[model samples]
Target: MKWKKLLAATLALGISAVVMAGCGSDKAASNGEKALVIGDTTFNSSNEEPDVNPHNAYAGWACIRYGIGETLIKYSDKMELQPWLATKWENVDEFTWKFTLRDDVTFSSGRKMDAAAVKQCLEHLIANNKRAAQDLKIAAIEANGQELIIKTTEPRPALLNYLGDPYGCIIDVDAGFEQGIVAGTGPYIATDIKTDDHLVLKKNEHYWGGTPKLDKITIRTITDGNTLSSALQSGEVQAAYGMAYESYPLFKNDKYNISQISTSRCFFGKMNFDPDSVCADPAVRQAIAMGIDKENFVAKLLDGNGFPANGVFPAGPAFGGDKVKAEKFDLDGAKKVLEAAGWVDTDGDGIREKNGKKLVIKWLTYPSRQELPLLAESAQATLKEIGMQVEINNTADNNQVVKDTKAWDVYAMANVQAPTGDPEYWFTVFATSNATKNQGKYRSARLDALENQLSREFDPAKRAQLALDMQQVVLDDHAFVFCSFLKMSMISKANVKNYTSHACDYYQVTADLDVE
Candidate 1:
């Protein structure tokens, strides 16, 4: 996890390599005009294609981020919930809620976004989208004139927050699912999709928010961070997202504008708690936690771009409470813990062993974000110094690799912990026993209880206390090595106006975005 500094050294050369590789070209015009091109590193056509289904978490968010979709509620630039589609909502009971839809809203396909449409979309998502199905726990969605009544399986005080998630976007079900085309209520309509390459979107003339300034938008997929930066520099792209921290220097000139927003995203290593897993032992997990220097990792590796994490959540009121602080880095303490746990370097091969079994750990990661593999490599080097054998696997298919490989002990990944501005979402997705994203299989009764309390508590003060309690429990158990809070950066041409970054890391491009 400490590779940010080392990676910075090669940024110049990386950008040069991309420029030399012929990544730059003349700005492609659309309909006899310059189309605003956005280059992003996180665009994956395999999961995003076929209408950018809101059922898939990442793709759903991408659709919302790129202004191809809209949710019932949305977070403003100040991280406050604001009305988008549904003007207002009221809680009828502990499990029942009602939302009032905007009568003027219409899908790009000319379908009115009525209560019936919202109900159909919610029902489809609850039945098909695994994350939505689990998070919402909706028992029924009924259309009542211009309002929609939702009944959940349990008390959901943060139901509006959950509904504001990207997956809750209302789409023209007939057009999106049946025809495999994105017909949304946003300001843009997806016109063409070329898998793994680019997606073309046209301004929605029927948009309730009025016509967008740009007539056309081309979202180009450039997975490499350096190439994304080079594209912006070469005038091929008007804006670039997921830019490497090192590449910011390239846009320091007044001609370019850089927006860095600190988000709830945390880069961390998840330790598997399965009985046979090497990281199953608390001592081993603690040793691994202590082995990595998170302070230095954030300060030096990330070039002071990120905040060092102490607990599971990042620094914020909605998620990070007053109870969290950075864990002390103690390399000597780590060695002592391993030794006390009966692991020692018996063969003098620099790797600890117990009962003739070498203490080797398989670290799994992906390269979609250029920093992950580098972080894994850095963790490998640090763990090796602590007399642990670390094998790194930087694969494209992390899900398949994790499913097939039984040797994986640690998985380095990054996630927006509070995507919904609630701690319940993060805890339910990554900490609960039955969580789909909890690939590590970490389970704790106390943590689960705290999560349940957080979900049901309506009082802001009580909810914040419950969230902090959960963070303390996870920190005490050493569930994972919390690294740093990500600072999402967007580099764009100076003329790109109304392009602001949000803390949730969800909304990027909006109808307001325009070139001056």
Candidate 2:
């Protein structure tokens, strides 16, 4: 009843909020102590954030996002590379990179951070983390004093950008994981961690950057959007990470602060290209791409909190956004394309049939990301209008279902297309023929060759154009239907300070974060 009441009454109205369920109050900041609680939707195992251990399968997202870890390199507000743990880096050769580590840095383990510490951490990462090892492609590492040298297996043009990734968070491997936690050079040190529940953190007094603003911080895993909304509204939490777009109106006022920015988090569909699947048909793939109303979906269902995507990347960089052309939402055009390909509703049941088989799209998606299920349901309705039957299989066991390619026609998922602010990440992870996560198994010789060129390319302008060419190859094949780009947002109370949003969407809690 209280949560329902608070949902109707926005925090912008200045409701007398308390100290986050009184969980952090030790006489209510009597000695000028500061505490904060953040409700994050993407902290559970379902989002690949089982713990703060950076080496364990995307847990690095939690490691970096929660201020428990710091990377050697970080991205600026413009997605440009910035010095973090490492001060200055030099591209020594085509296959070698030299990094100058910060001499003043010390891990929470009380160990001095040097080239040896960083070298040990990176070596441990290469051995334990497969994804990081693959992205970094490190052949050998040499350390001398405060300088760290990394020799890649090949010429990695985007090596610096990859280093800015979450997995690049430097941790003290020698400290060991007592409870899936490690010593890091972040503003905060993770003290207590309970999976799917809460993570308690304390300020790192010897933090390298600056004295942390908050003395204590609690990050609560609130997966439900409504509960997260109510928690922040009732002051059960001071801030929220994954607020529903429909709930945006409730916090748009003086009492609340909404930090939002356009990110490369694209929600797209990968058409099943299995020979046995109906989506294997080119007309079906094209129709599927052209039928879904992305513009209306962004404007209405998304509450205008996203951009209608034209390609894998959003509109800004030379490689992504509107650099290339793709199919638009045209129902008539979709129907004509299907009809031309000999798929027609002969039975007049508003369901198309091709040679005795009905054009049924078995859409497989998960609900971990709030907007994904919404996209599936919305596409289901719109696809029906064009004589296509959509059987929705929205489930949490999507990873299991996807293993059987016969089960799905179009597998839709939300992904950060460019987490490292580079075009190669999306293609290498999802589009390349050798990509392990290539959901649709779509392949093109031209695309693979272009990727090879992009990998070795050192010039900035050439790399940008190469990325654009690769996007066109996928679009021409109708392999993936690019839907919309997410506008990442973080909702905080007016009293919270500097808990800002980043374009990279990796850095959240930082030394600047404070509570009034």
Candidate 3:
């Protein structure tokens, strides 16, 4: 009743579009104050973006997303790498790369950005961040005035792409990370940071780039979609990210602009391979793959925002999409697969049983990504029809809970499978045998060997083929189920300028972002 009433009250914008100037009212307040607040769904600690310290966990995402940090390289709309802090770079040898630094950049803490600063930042990152240390085998680094050279422990063909990761945001290590805030060379400087609450930021007056327009910016973590929508409607926030698809209809007026783009962000499930777990059975994994209605889930549940994904990487890059194959939705085929695995509905209670146990999938997921919970519920209903019982454990403590292999049979989560516009990011973090966050404990010897070849191969064509081969290995094993890619949208008031969405989804707030 509350949701329906809220929807009813918010839907009046359709009628207001005729009477008023547009769906939202014209600016009646003074333009002197340029304080802007944005409602974000995944801004909390639960999403691993707890603070603006780039070296701490995944907090670098928050640092980059909110314009508190800048990387040496950034991705363009075409997903190609462009130099940011670095003027130019070149591969010196099989294990060495050198970069020319910009001469005029300074950190928010008033320190000059030189090759020494860059060297200090990366050394601290490789020492603290496990994923960074593994991905970037930086055996040694040499610093000269504006010339910084890096020598990897091995031949890393994709080193530049890995450096563009959110964790690659360069900061002034000497300034220190006090109160989770580092001296960054970005447009904004974080003032206060509270986990699972809100972040306060102010424009960097001495920013090396263009002058920041807004005086103050607040990023409020609104976990609930309804509350985020209501806040935007009530003028509490000038913009909102992660608004529910159902509420998108309320904001599709002349007054609100929805900046949307297709992203490689995917909602996929990793099957646990515990020895005694049912997901250990290859047939059970195959049946579970074919059981979910991915097409309908995207059409109805997702409101046709995105397309059903066939593999880990979407169909944009040479190694993405149809290059690999996954299971299709076929109820009859799924039933046969389950029966062949000795799981049957012996008691005729609709759900299948094996020996004395029921065919129940402990579906573990988190609620921070709105699409994830929706996918879990959607899968629960669809899997039920295919003689499987899904017990969902959707909580914010998912990072801790997923650590226990026995607690979850299938863990559904949202990740940018190709955040760096490279297929290697996905395999190194999840699919590889020694993956940093391989919560499912899935190991494929062939996949590991292929990833080894991919890491050292410098040729783009050969890398693409190796990636294609690696994806097929995991898909054939039914280790991960790729559901649908995300079509992200950022709904903001019409007055907001340059608050556009990026294909990379790494950048949001910038010096150009202003409310006029």
Candidate 2 lDDT, tens digit per residue, 1-516?
322232234232211222243453421343345778888887887767789999888889999998989898899868888898999999999999999999998988788899999999999998998778878899999999999999999999899998888888998887887667778889988766778777877788889788998887778888788888888887778888988888889999998999999888889999888998999999999999999999988999899999899998988754566989999899999999999999999989999999899999999987767778889988998889988999999876787788898999999988888889789998988888877578789899999999999999999989999999999999999999999999999999898988788888888999999887
> What lDDT would each prediction earn against the true structure?
0.77, 0.85, 0.86
1-516 in candidate 3: lDDT tens per residue? 322332244334322222221123223223343667788999877788878888999999999999989998899977899999988999999999999989999888788899998999999999999999999999999999999999999999999999999999989887777667777899987766668877777688889997898876778888999988888988777898888887999999998999999888898999999987789889889998998899998999889988898988888665568878899999899999998889999999999999888999999999878878889999998889889999999999999998999899999998888888788988999989899989889999999999999999999989988988988999999999999998988999989888888888988999998887
Across 64-119, the per-residue lDDT of candidate 1 in tens digits comes to: 88788899999865567888899998899999998898999988777788999888
Q: Candidate 1: where is the Cα deviation over 4 Å?
A: 1-30, 45-51, 178-180
The better candidate by TM-score, 1 or 3, is 3
How does each model score on TM-score?
0.91, 0.92, 0.94
Quickly count the clashes in candidate 3: 0
Model 2 score (lDDT): 0.85
**Where is model 2 more than 4 Å wrong at Cα?**
1-33
Clashes of each: 1, 1, 0
